[model samples]
Target: MKNRVDFIDWLKAVGMFLIVLGHYFGEPFDQFTQPIYPKQLGVAFFVFVMGWGLASETRPQWQVVYNRLFPMYFWGVVIAIFISLIFMLTKGHPAITNYLPFIGGINVLGNFFPSNPTTWYIGTYLHIILLWALVMRKVNVTLPLILLVLFCEIAIRSIFIEFERLFTGYMLVSNWITVFMLGMYMHQQKDNHNNLKALLIMVLWALLLFTWASLLNPLNITQTFPFRLPVEHSTLISSLVVSVAISTVYLSNTLLAVKFFSGIPANPVVRFFSRNTIFIFIGHMPLYDVAEPIALIFVESGWGKRAIIVFIMYVGLAVVSELLHKAVNIDKLKKHLWLRLN
Candidate 1:
């Protein structure tokens, strides 16, 4: 069995790239890829990949939790504090209320949601991992079982729309349960040589549904509002759309295992992007605070100028990521924290 799957790495790199570009597309870049970047799709692909990775670990151990889960929380807090400082400096008072969502108060009342929109992903990811830690200790992590859990949550939400919509909107453990499980299933079948037929079926099914949904309503392709944020959720249509998108990426990589993508998992560039996905994800939003203002100056400067801005943003961020990787060394710090805290 292969230790590293290049296609998975490729998919991760592509997904993170889309995510950053999606967040970056506000002023100057919005026109370049309006209603096409599929931000939710990138996030969904990431969650699915996470689930795939978690599939092998039936018993959620402390070391894995400390290593894998702590970074998001660590960065989430760091970002939250950073934002708080900004708020104080700019607004004359550090508004702790604004940062409430970071502590699981995003959409508790069914209407009040993430004021700091970027915080939802990391916060919800933490909740999902914590739940898995507690529950997977007693039960097995499998596709059917996860599907049942998803169905039950869906049913409950249907019954108590207001309550579920309010609470589950932010604490999204149950909302995306199905997609996460599907990711685990993907991991389970990683070595399937017969995946070509299944991949074709998934592609066809995805296309058919997308076309059908688009013909009836094109908005379906781009409309994902999980937790009242402009992010993807675990709705039936969304689940299918994201699942197919991820599968397509994986299958495409597998089928076309040559040229640039060949041995890509080991390639330094691909490895950097794939491994630093969380860093890119967390850092990009803040970087946008700076990049957006600069890009806006060149908003009307034509495509060539806009293209340069995009390239600079990508390269600058990549450099920062590399620097951050070398400077603080997040993994080592997390391990250190775990040692001290434990």
Candidate 2:
């Protein structure tokens, strides 16, 4: 359990860090060819690790999942409101007071929201965890669970078992859930000296991902639209790569990354985001909106220049978010306000 916590914690740091990096590197340069998607690993890893964590922590008692997940998501909603208000004010729009589905989109980051596309993962995550207990209650072990998931995915791919109308929400479990099961399987198989086996698995997964990533969309063989059939090969590749990354961290014995970063306390790369990691994720868009357009204002700016500016903007946003988070600890504030209201 302690190792699990350590491995998961580090995985979270690495996974989320990649997400930030992915965003900074989201778009490819026009002059030079790049991967179909650069920022995907961050998001895919986030989900895959969530699966790994969920599987190990709640193999039996899934009730705890709700207890852990809801507060964060509820706070995610509150943060969205904060962002929406700021956006409205900045854009000179009227105060957003009336209730609407937009809020649903915001709360979970977008299966319903329109602000940004990637946020849908948050909502999907919240919804899936709620149903996970029931799902796991009926399903069996992690390997079998993974197999069932693959069958479900293949059917979805071949158009055998269609649910086009049942639940359009991104939260409805699909391929994402399968990777989650994969995470659990990885976790369950983890043993003190099983590093070789883990490395072998990781290598195999990586090769599969590399092959898929190199081919998908570039060939345009399938319609890889969002929320549609024929899942993007990029997405599959990203998911697999993320799973390998998570598995690698646990399978490796050396704390090389931690040690290397820990040594460079003053290094800009290491220290720049040391504090503002989590908060920045919630509030980055407003900064990005302003920063990206401004970068465009320079008529001669290239993608390389734009990329550099975005990186700087992400850092600045991180700094600002950390400060905002410092100004208010939502959980504590909520408790205090509730006490007074009560």
Candidate 3:
């Protein structure tokens, strides 16, 4: 179990890195440039990891909600304010409108959106955690219930155009429950399945995704959302690929942990990646958003210059995020604040 958990950490490390790449490159696999992994799938994988963590911890609902919600609110608001201020300082203007989403202060109804593009996930995550908390307390969390919730979310979006615009037109918390539930289900059923079976399932999902990708309008889902599908993919396809790939890793890790593939020691690299994923995911975007204009001037059609800039931005933000993560320690601060407020 321990080694299996380690494997999941490794998977998350890889997934998080892919997320950074996906956002930085912007539709990395969309063009026929190369046969690359779907970069946008990274966020979906993160949510999968979230579901797994929820299953593994099995803490009280309030505790789970508190732990997840506060960091998002705290850091999300901070990052929004900070970025808005940077824009204001650099461009010489008031940035209140840019920062409004951070504090739930949108002008129009159904427009309570995050100003930072990446913070949308945090908002979606907040919704998912709250919904899961409420549902877990009310009834047994069956597969049917999971499907029902997903269906309801889709139905609500279909019925209300305004809400869809507010919470990203395509990939809302509602649309994502399926993948999140898949993660929870994977964790709950980990012991019952075998690696070979999981691999087979992954292959089947891949084939299905490929077929669907050929038939669907890929951008239909992401047009108004945080991320659009690469030119020829759909949400269903991406979700299936993300869920199956993560599940495959879980099964493979479990197998390897039991000496299926021996002689691997502690993976410090993977540990670093997992440990700093949150920071990497949150920090990379703003760094790139700021550096992109500069990169364009120095980056002619050459891969070397562009690649170098990417590496520098990623590493620089990672170091800063690590320092901030340690220095701020939001969990402890939240506890302190809660104690005083009560």
Ranking by lDDT: 1, 3, 2
TM-score of each: 0.70, 0.61, 0.68
What do the candidate models score in CA lDDT, each in turn? 0.55, 0.46, 0.54
Report the lDDT tens digits of candidate 2 across residue range 188-276.
53323345554665565556555545644364332222322333434544434433332333222122222222222233433345445
Locate the minimum summed-lDDT window of 10 residues in model 3.
Answer: 257-266
lDDT of 1 by residue, 48-136 (tens): 76766766674436666666667776766776677778877877766464355456534333344443555567656766666556665
Q: Model 3, 1-342: lDDT tens per residue?
A: 343555456556666766666554545343311112344456656776677667666566777777777776776667667777787878775445444434432322244444455555665666667667876334445778766765565554443332225344333565556667766766643332345654665566556455544544333444433323334443554544433332333333233332211222327766766776666666566666566666667775456555655665566666776788888877788888767755
The C-alpha RMSD in Å for every predicted model, in order, reads 6.7, 7.9, 6.9
Candidate rank order under TM-score: 1, 3, 2
Residue runs of model 2 more than 4 Å from their true location after superposition? 1-10, 17-24, 27-38, 58-67, 90-113, 137-140, 157-171, 188-210, 213-218, 221-278, 293-300, 330-342
User: How many angstroms is residue 315 displaced in model 1 relative to the true structure, after the best TM-score fit?
Assistant: 4.2
In candidate 2, what residue range of length 10 has the lowest lDDT sum?
Answer: 29-38
Count clashes in each candidate, considering only residues at least 3 apart in sequence or on different chains: 1, 2, 0
Report the C-alpha displacement of residue 121, candidate 3, in angstroms. Answer: 2.0
Residue 32 of model 2 has an lDDT of 15
Report the lDDT of model 1 for residue 75: 67
